[model samples]
Target chain A: MTFSTDIHVDKVRALLQAMEAGDERCTVEILDDITQIRKSELHQQLSELTKNLHQTLDDLDVDTPVLLHAKHDLPDITERLQYVLNETQKASDKTLGSSENTLGLLEEVGTMLEGSDEVSKIQPLLDQASQELTNIMLAQSFQDLTGQVLNRVILIVTELEESLKALIERSRHDYDAIPQKTQSEAEQSAEHEKGVGPNVTAKSKLDAVESQADVDDLLSDLGI
Target chain B: MQINRDMNILVVDDFSTMRRIVKNLLKELGFSKFDEADDGATAWPMVQSGKYDFIVSDWNMPQMTGIDLLRHVRADEKLKDTPFLLITAEAKRSQILEAAQAGVDGYIVKPFTAATLNEKIQKIFERVAEKQNK
Candidate 1:
């Protein structure tokens, strides 16, 4: 039982004026038209909103898992985050091990220096320490790997947030509102061809290889 | 033919950290000359301009993909014989097959050890030498 504000007010005023003039037929006709217009307007609004919502849902494929089901994508995100945690942990362990070994080598060098200033004796120890330090630096590569994974997760989350925001904003407006445009099919499909960065859950997937050995085996079988 | 330890190498990856790790590993393997590119797009220009003896690349990148770069290199009459190795996180059999089909000299999945990289590089050089001899 809703009507557009200006139209409803003007129609009611016209019907009252008609009634005052003892124009019963005119008043009845005005009332009928008002009811018909309101019904049509409401129906149009409902259909428009439904269409916009459908478009939003269709455009919400940020990733394969997100495209399939949002709930299903949650566990995948968790697994990706878990991978980040494991990578960071391994990096820290490697860094610590290298640092400790470097420290031990430095201590040995210090003792040798205290005993005698032989360049040959100190050089090997210093070289070993330098190698360990390089190991420490290499271990920091985990940051890059984990950062890429987080960026992907963030992208999916951001896409979901934007879709939800659009839905909310559209729901607040009437049927006469312009529809939000969606991404083209070509653009969405192109994202699939781009390589999926670091398979965090490779162990669980049958299509993905878990190790370099697996890759080597496959390549050898192909005679490469 | 003996592998040249002093040969110029081009390392292509989007991540600077990865490039540094690869460079350090190569240094450990006695390779002294090195160059780096952030992606295949940037690497392709360098590959065209420079006389790189070897190319190591990552698969996924924003502007151009490693596989595309590999194809470009292989198609070039002058650079077709340059050794190209793919080091990437893309471990699918299909992707490995694609690299092989595109004439990749070596393929090493990410999270690979220095030993694996060394082994792959040695094997690639050996095969290239054998092909040249034939």
Candidate 2:
């Protein structure tokens, strides 16, 4: 194939130079012959390309069973992840709820003691308990943080399922003619989805403005 | 600048636990008259009824986010000047700016102490008081 293409290419170059050098009569005749030769070569290359594509597709078909099995397990993975999120949320709520109730009782006890003349005896201990309960309640805000992080993972997994399905479907199509998306296109879509969800890592480079004061300062700098 | 303990306040969050936590903290701060909504969509009509004296909302909700509620409230002539506070885990600079531009009275990041909530609410009231005095 390469030898024939090289011969055709040398012949075409010689013909073009002849046409450029004022040889007009035979140039059209030989140019038409060269066109036919180029067309036949293109047809041969196309057949080879098609054969290679079929071969790749056959290889993908061999792996289709594994892909299908993986796809089948994705939903179960999603469900288990959801279960973790829900259970953790429930535990967090129960712990925080009970702590709040205890804090409420402690507050009442402290108030009653404050109203009494015997304020010095157990007031410190009650105050300490109140502070500790408040800390426990604050700590349970971990549920919201964890939930947000889990939701981001769920988003990624959901997108992965779609990609996997698309890959499985690609095996059924003559996909060589279709233009695949570039890496930058995928990156742009990912960027659009990024930075909005919970900062799972407190040290995330995307948004390190951890405290409310920093939020205020940033907004203030933006002149909001 | 003092918060009126008896004034009606609406607490909006998608999570029931968050609403409960905010309400508990509010109770600790002596604000008892409370209405709870699961999301901003539910809170909008309640705010429009002119019953809520203050609004403390979580930002990342399902139906309508806290920013959307803030926009709706700010757009309404009846509720434009309502003291709106955002209690959210969204710590991004862009989100904070969006809420501020939507006329949020204050912003409190999540994992916050009851004391922080109290301080932010107090600061909002103080600013409102100063504006009215002006």
Candidate 3:
């Protein structure tokens, strides 16, 4: 069944108009209808692209598992994306207050340094303030480290999506593997819901235990 | 037991930072015969070519991840005997069991120290040595 973009466009326009009108309640039914329609169309487009890839590349002998891997990587990536989002929220909450305080310290140090009359009296105090600011910056802002790592991850994930398209173009093969990736991602989320936050980096409130023997076994397993 | 110094090693992970860290650690472990693959899909062909003796792989990679690669290696007759170790952030019970079931030589969770890496590699070799002797 073909979905006319025009209808979807009109509904979206209507939805935006409702929002612009300061309508507090955008009915759930209306939202669901728009989402379902949009998703179906998106999936259809995806299917078409897959078919195009198959017709173009799979006929050739080039191995496209890399491409297929990228395709299948989406679900896990989406999960990871959500995780990054959550972590970013947590990180922001933890650090943003301290970060602003550190910046305020910067202004204070600058203001004191610029004062000519009390230079000798304030010099040592200013020096201590500067040092404290640096310490706070280091403690509060992982901008240079985790920020860089997370940024790189985001870029690579985006590249994987683009590369999947290119690999399909290069191989002309539709990767049947994409769905498997999604299925695996679904399994992971389900498992995590059952009490294992496998990919979680932050210390959790959950009653999960890390055993010393398990760590020992892990060491042994590492072939050390 | 091929004591081939020429035997290549493939380090598989989507993260270049991780790949570098693992490769450096492996280098320190006296294994310079090495190569890098971004993920399992990329590493498989190298393994299939019978050119690699060792695989130090990250479990959570884009395609053909460490676990998947180890499984593939275990399932394939020619590659089955090759020593495969998993380096990952994933240290869940079922995941570890799954890797063990797939015949992984070792599993190293992330934020691992160099000492930890060395210990794991030594244990793997000792196990392999015992098996060969038997």
Candidate 4:
């Protein structure tokens, strides 16, 4: 079994040690009391980490993929998120282009009427034009608000960037603590072809949740 | 064990995020010579055309896969011995075994960090150097 920094609470660790050494009375209750608090704590950290990482990603102008629910699934979410970001940017660009076109039309009309003595006739036309101008100005004003909202997102993202960097760094440290097998697994893929890709091993991921006790054991078998 | 830092690096994956992540990691590792392809199919011709010294590829991609790409690389008289690393999320014993048999220069399981990449790349370089010595 892998040592969990997560399950490092004194009481829980002690309980696990006590229970592991204990005899047949070792029931689900032992697993429960020791792991319950730690499990909940881990759940909290995961939620917090996800929330922070996503927020930071937004600051970096990244989108959260609709399909991303967990870590093992990042590849899918990253793909979908790219599409989402692409579509969003396209829509935003279209909106800005439409607004710019309206502004251009208004500018041309204003320029044409600049020296006309038909100020009275132009006055009524100008009234309609001026109303349209106000609408354009209002729209432009809303654009400023959009820009401000973008800035706020940027601010929050900066905060999350530092947070996630720390989290990843900490995880790396934890990973280093886990001993890896000395044997080389480098040449085996050529010798066999039955398994899928190395990155999307869903079996291990599923096995992660249902059986934490088996996590280290299985990874060792995988030579990781 | 040194990677020719100036050599062109190709980052291939169906996921743009991963491509970006790998690129960024490469940049962080002080190598900015890079390009990207979304899958091995799209990446194949580029590898054929470009003088790529290092290729960091994802195992599972849309058009072509890392294994097929690796085989293609080994088959090519010109591209042989170029470093080919497969980075993936799969961690099953079976898949790991398969990648080994494919003669991948190095393998990295996903959700990995910059440091892990450093370790794998160094090990790959060392292996390559050892073989060259022999």
Candidate 5:
């Protein structure tokens, strides 16, 4: 359905003209053949475009997500990235504070140990060090929180990749043209026990598997 | 209600760092015994083993999600009574309701604090005590 230079309007008109003059059987056969050839042409053009775009992305050092951002006119990711940076900084500060407090307690204990004969005098400092260590442990929880946030960001980036890939593949007349199998096919080949990744954001989630025909039809309407 | 500090606990999350963090937090709260699995797939077998008295799991994982694991645990007669707490970043009301219907003992949204976890665990224990008293 995509309207491209490769469609060859003259060739299509010739086929239609032949169909009009021929017997019913010959007309049906010629129409089917023309349709198949058009499908193949669309696939070829799509594959070439995808290849060129991929190479351009590589040359520019821009990933598919960046390309998606450009195409979608997405908001800057700087704020999200900045949030991560801030959290990490706060966690590090908490960790350093706890560690330095523990260090001071240790030093006090060491001083008491050197000056006094009784071990009980250092007990209070040891207790304080233990509490500070616990604070350090609590501060360490930031790693997990930050990790989860980063993982969510990673999921977003991956979803962007999927959307971009899906868009490119959509230009093809057939879903089977991509070398990589569809998710369903991959699931079956893996015995259907393979787990899917986390759910993506609402927008990309819908884009994941829109029919190739629909995309081609839209492109055709746009005269692309 | 007095917490059973000796309870055998299973902490499930794909991230090892999260697992360790949760374990340390539990230790701070005076709970010592711990077991860990990276994902719900691995944790399912451990849950089935009937060794753990409590489960604290992250919702999003590679092999099986925490919701899937919770469903499995609830379906199994022996494991049904085990205190299962879900930790998730998902804040959708529908998901929260689904987890509740799936028989999760408690839900904790992520980037949670130690105080939040402790409070939820305490509440779960209180509910269990009330059920036992009834």
Candidate 6:
């Protein structure tokens, strides 16, 4: 993939000669010719670079995870994460249902013992148990919040797989033959509006409110 | 105007876990009647068809977003006055501002305590009462 720069060298020599002779018009013409030669040489170099990249990609082992990830691992990971989401949801719901049933039974027991001197002794303990059960139910909300985070991770993995597959597919053809695709403003804004899920770490906070009070203050400031 | 414990409340989120959690919190608050939707797109038709008194929705979803749903509700003459609350992990000031501008009745950041949910719902109803009184 050698580029012939002899024409470029000849053009540069002609440009220097024209400049030395103080011929302004010839100098200008030779300067334009040199610029064109340099442009074509750059184009040739870029084409060679693209060819080498394609060859390198083609030489990659078929078993490499980058290629296999698009075909197998990524979808497998997505399915596994989805399974996690489903199972956790089922567990949370089961806990919630059982707790609610227990609370109901406790209420019935409290009613059955109402107006007895024994009620005072039994009531406080029952109330404490009820509160604990409620707390347990509330704690199950972790599944929801964590599940949202997991959903985002799964989406990112799927996107990574798609990008890898696209890159691999592109490498099989002439790079410049494909027209460059840019995201339209509408598409970009639509993606922006989709909103990122919960920030997993402090670094990704992006000026987010730290607490309910901060949210309240912002809403108040907005006169809502 | 008093807060209606039996108000037809609609809970919307992409995750069933979240929908259940929000419903459980509402139950803890003594609100019994409720409906659920997985996203704003699903909720929209329900909102139009059902005589919902309030809506509690998540900000991020696949088909449609909470803010867009809020806009739709506000733009609809029939449902404009229904209370809309956003419970989401999107805590950015700009997002809060956007929800406020979209006529969201309340905003509660995610992983919120039951106390916060209770208080926000109470505050929203109080404001709604004030407006009705006016």
Among all candidates shown, the one with the greatest TM-score: 1
lDDT of 1 by residue, A1-224 (tens): 75476366778899999999999999999989988887888899999998987777555444333333433444466677767777777877778776877778777777667747586677786878777677777767777777777867767776775564555445453222323334486763353246777777644354778888888888898777
Question: In candidate 2, what are the lDDT values of residues A46-164, reduced to their tens digit?
Answer: 99998886577557643354454445556556776787798788788888889988988987887778667788878988888888888988898888888999999888888888876
| Shift of residue A22 alpha carbon in model 1, Å | 48
The number of clashing residue pairs in model 1 is 0
TM value for model 6: 0.54
Q: How far does residue A51 in candidate 1 sit from its true spot (Å)? A: 16
Best by DockQ: 1
The chain B TM-scores of all candidates, as shown, are 0.97, 0.96, 0.92, 0.92, 0.97, 0.96
Worst 10 residues of 4 chain A by lDDT: A61-70
lDDT of 6 by residue, B37-113 (tens): 99899999999985799999998998999889999999999889999999998876767887888888899988788
Q: Please give, for residues B17-115, the per-residue lDDT of candidate 3 as tens digits.
A: 888888888777677888888878988888899988788888776555677778788889888999988777666766666677678878776657798
Provide the TM-score for each candidate, comma-separated.
0.64, 0.52, 0.46, 0.41, 0.53, 0.54
User: Model 3, range A1-224, lDDT digits (tens) per residue?
Assistant: 97676456767777787777777577454577878877888899999998876676655443445544566555456556657666765666566677667768766876867758877678777668768766765664554567677767777778777876666655645555333322376776445323232454333313222643474665456443
TM-score of 2: 0.52
Higher-DockQ candidate of 1 and 2: 1
User: Where does model 5 exceed 4 Å of error?
Assistant: A1-69, A72-79, A104-115, A119-224
Residues A1-224, model 6: lDDT tens digits: 76555566677788889899999999999778767876887899999998998898887666554565566666667877876788789889989999999999999999999898899899999999999999999999999899999999999998987787778777673323333234596774464467766654343375678888898888887777
DockQ for all models: 0.69, 0.24, 0.08, 0.11, 0.10, 0.48
Per-residue lDDT for A188 in model 4? Answer: 45
Query: Interface RMSD value for candidate 4, one decimal?
Result: 6.2
Model 4 segments beyond 4 Å from truth?
A1-224
CAPRI grade of model 4? incorrect
Kindly report the TM-score of the first chain in candidate 2: 0.50
- Candidate 5 lDDT by residue in tens digits, A28-147: 766787688779987989999989876664454222344445334232343445456566777777777868777777777677687467767766767787776777767677767776
Task: Show model 6 residue runs off by greater than 4 Å.
Answer: A1-189, A201-203
User: Least accurate stretch of 10 residues (summed lDDT) in model 6 chain A?
Assistant: A173-182
RMSD of each: 10.9, 19.3, 18.3, 24.0, 19.2, 19.0
